[model samples]
Target: MSTDTTTEPEDASLEDLLARVDDLETRLADLEATPDDSQKMVVVATKGTLDMAYPPLILASTAAAFGYDVTVFHTFWGLDILHEERSSALKLSSVGNPNVPVPNAIAALPGMDEVTTRLMRKRIAENDVATVEELVDLSIETGVDLQACQMTIDLLGYDEDDFFDGVTTGVGAASAFREMVEADVQLLV
Candidate 1:
């Protein structure tokens, strides 16, 4: 005679639990087989003004610090960001800037842009914020590749010598686009 005392429902529940465990194990194995997706970053700088220039540099350097390969492609007006003569002196515009306390009408007044630019620079200095030059240096030090847009340089009649010393190369839009498409994170700023 058999002495097994387990009920039919209890045995069925045990089988269900084992099946669920197997399903979960399979899922875990699939997850383990997947490759990492956090490798590259590409940033596009389209504007050259002081306010517009900081984002690409800051993000590229920060990503580099996190061990991601970083590239910043400068195009059009953004070419000034890589210009040796103007990178440090890019000015913040008060016109149409909602963050400024002054009304748009007042901000658009003559010389208001200069005033706002001076104020912004003073505030940045007071707060120990990194200037564009410093951020560019940091990005370069962290192995961020700075690229100038060749089409823009040619259109604007600027020579390679016009760019800062840290630029890795001058490339066309297609090259920059390729980098953007390949990057895990692509930012346009």
Candidate 2:
């Protein structure tokens, strides 16, 4: 086959036209795919323990670090992250948390529950891992708002004084639920 020795014309106008079309199509597709402001994230943690305490604060902090506005609602045992004195006293129970290393000697020891709880807290500190308090601090530094359950506190005979300073507010389930519903992701960590 003989090839034609001819050059095709390059049209700058044609390229610009195609680029504009692609951009508009992409924008329309995105708008159709999901609602705007549905990117918000909410994390709720309802447990307070050496093992479970980090989720609410850690998840909220990390999410906020990623440039997403994150809110953490702490309820029930999860409220300990804000506890003034007992926050550090959060302990992992050997009775349920299988990940906790339990030596046979410690298991057989009298008052093993207390002994293990103490050991759990010590190990967490020695490892330099973030405590519930530290994670809560990070969340605060990252602009992650904290909400403690006032109902839980009142039932426990506690008050705002029970929580650490810099906490944004204490609210009930209704307020927390409203925030969660507004968020794209609602999770119980």
Candidate 3:
């Protein structure tokens, strides 16, 4: 059988539809050409536990790998994520973590935190996952900006020496807020 070849219907409706389609395509191209929100990402790290700390560091590093300008603002307990002494030793807090197999009462018992933390670290190592210290180094090497919360530092009586080398001068929440406002993507991890 021969293939059928037909020209346009030569009707106003079909012509109008084609013109609309062209307009839509042009607009779609314009939209695609515009800068993506992922161009910049700001992550707030506010937890110190092993389970809670990885997300911001991981996301910041991943964004940096994508050539995004990424900043991780460590506040409150999250300060441990960048602490030179504690970063590698950040413990899993099973007391309130629902994912842990232990009941809350058992988890809250003395010595349970140590057990849980060890188990978590063992699992992480077994899976060949990067440690917090490794992720911190990777993030710095990849140009991820890390900032410590000045207020928390003062409140916790922590000196600048407590943090790793890559952190910027401590920043208060206001500065972090300004960065967040300018960021195309923001996360509290």
**Residue-level lDDT tens digits of model 1 in 94-176:** 98889999999999899998899999999999999998988888888889999998888898888899887879655888888
Is 1 or 3 the stronger prediction by TM-score? 3
**Candidate 1 residue-wise lDDT at 109:** 91
Question: What does candidate 3's lDDT look like per residue over 52-137, in tens digits?
Answer: 88899889999998989998999889999999998888898888789889899999999899999999899999999999999999
**Candidate 3 pairs with clashing backbones:** none
Of models 1 and 2, which has the larger TM-score?
1
Among the numbered candidates, top TM-score falls to 3
> Which 10 successive residues of model 1 have the least lDDT summed?
1-10
Question: What is residue 75's positional error in candidate 1, in angstroms?
Answer: 0.5
Worst 10 residues of 2 by lDDT: 1-10
Report lDDT per candidate: 0.88, 0.76, 0.89
CA deviation > 4 Å runs, candidate 2 = 1-38, 100-110
Alpha-carbon TM-score of each model against the true structure? 0.77, 0.71, 0.78
| Cα TM-score of candidate 3 | 0.78
By lDDT, who's the top model here?
3
Clashing pairs in 2: 47-78
